[model samples]
Target: MSDSQRFPVAAHALAYMAHKGAFSPAQAAPSALLAASVPTNPVVVRRVTALLAKAGLIATRPGATGGSWLLRQPEDIRLDEVLKAVNGCAHIGSPPAGAKGCPISEHIPRQVGKALTAADEAATEALSKITIADLLDENPVSLAAYTPHASCPVAA
Candidate 1:
């Protein structure tokens, strides 16, 4: 699998919120809660949370009773947005720079590069159609449900 195929923490965190029915237009999770679900430290969750928060996908609160929550309906949040927020790169594979004067990469065709770019565009378009609500409806199984660990992987 490509590096892009690896699950992004933002997606995981959102899915967790969805499964728990924690997605409220005004509600938000505390850094600790997000970290626990993602099975990572608060710092990592904070990073991802900040990204989502910036995208207008989630809202955060300060002081006691403060936590993060979905800022919009789950149906309004696109998978592609989440992917972009966390990964910060095109979903399609990134090609390595070719050696200078390499005939195959340079002279052979521009079509290959165009095709890759097109594929990435198509993928993002398709991903944009999927929303967090779709995932919630599917009853996505949580990693903690099957794992024996007392806390989430991140918390450990």
Candidate 2:
């Protein structure tokens, strides 16, 4: 409904890239491959990746043998930065356009708006402390052969 998951998916793609990019930048995965990992469409991956590329979070190449590479180390890339790349954490809802007469409508924008803004800011602050490295480090299995875009799950 809110489509609030866009940022997380973007972050996921980044973390996934981080897993693979540590090996080499040329090993950057394609959007179709990334799509498979995100379990979403390649177009969605491209759209988000474009934003990330513009934000300098990742680098992309076109044509045959081209793909995305992480622009920085996972430890240096914060979650909030990824979210900001996709404009992911922005508040989506707002008071109705015509609240000229109603008291509840008038106050809702001021009060509720403030609350939503504060919540988003708090979330960003919390995310700022976390990095793609944190996500990978938190997962023991990632140290194995579980690179992103790899079709297989955990190795036995």
> Could you say which candidate leads in lDDT?
2
TM-scores, all candidates, are 0.68, 0.79
lDDT comparing candidate 1 with the true structure: 0.67
| lDDT tens readout by residue for model 1, 70-102 | 767677788888877765545455456566788
Write down the worst ten-residue block by lDDT for model 1: 140-149
lDDT for position 111 in model 2: 83
Model 2 over residues 25-96: C-alpha lDDT tens digits? Answer: 569788888889878888888888898999998888876677788878888888889888887766757756
The Cα local distance difference test for each model comes to 0.67, 0.78
**Candidate 2 stretches greater than 4 Å from native:** 1-3, 22-25, 90-92, 97-99, 139-156
Query: What TM-score does candidate 1 reach?
Result: 0.68
Worst 10 residues of 2 by lDDT: 140-149
CA lDDT of 72 in candidate 2? Answer: 88
What TM-score would you give candidate 2 relative to the actual structure?
Answer: 0.79
Cα error of candidate 1 at position 18, Å:
3.8
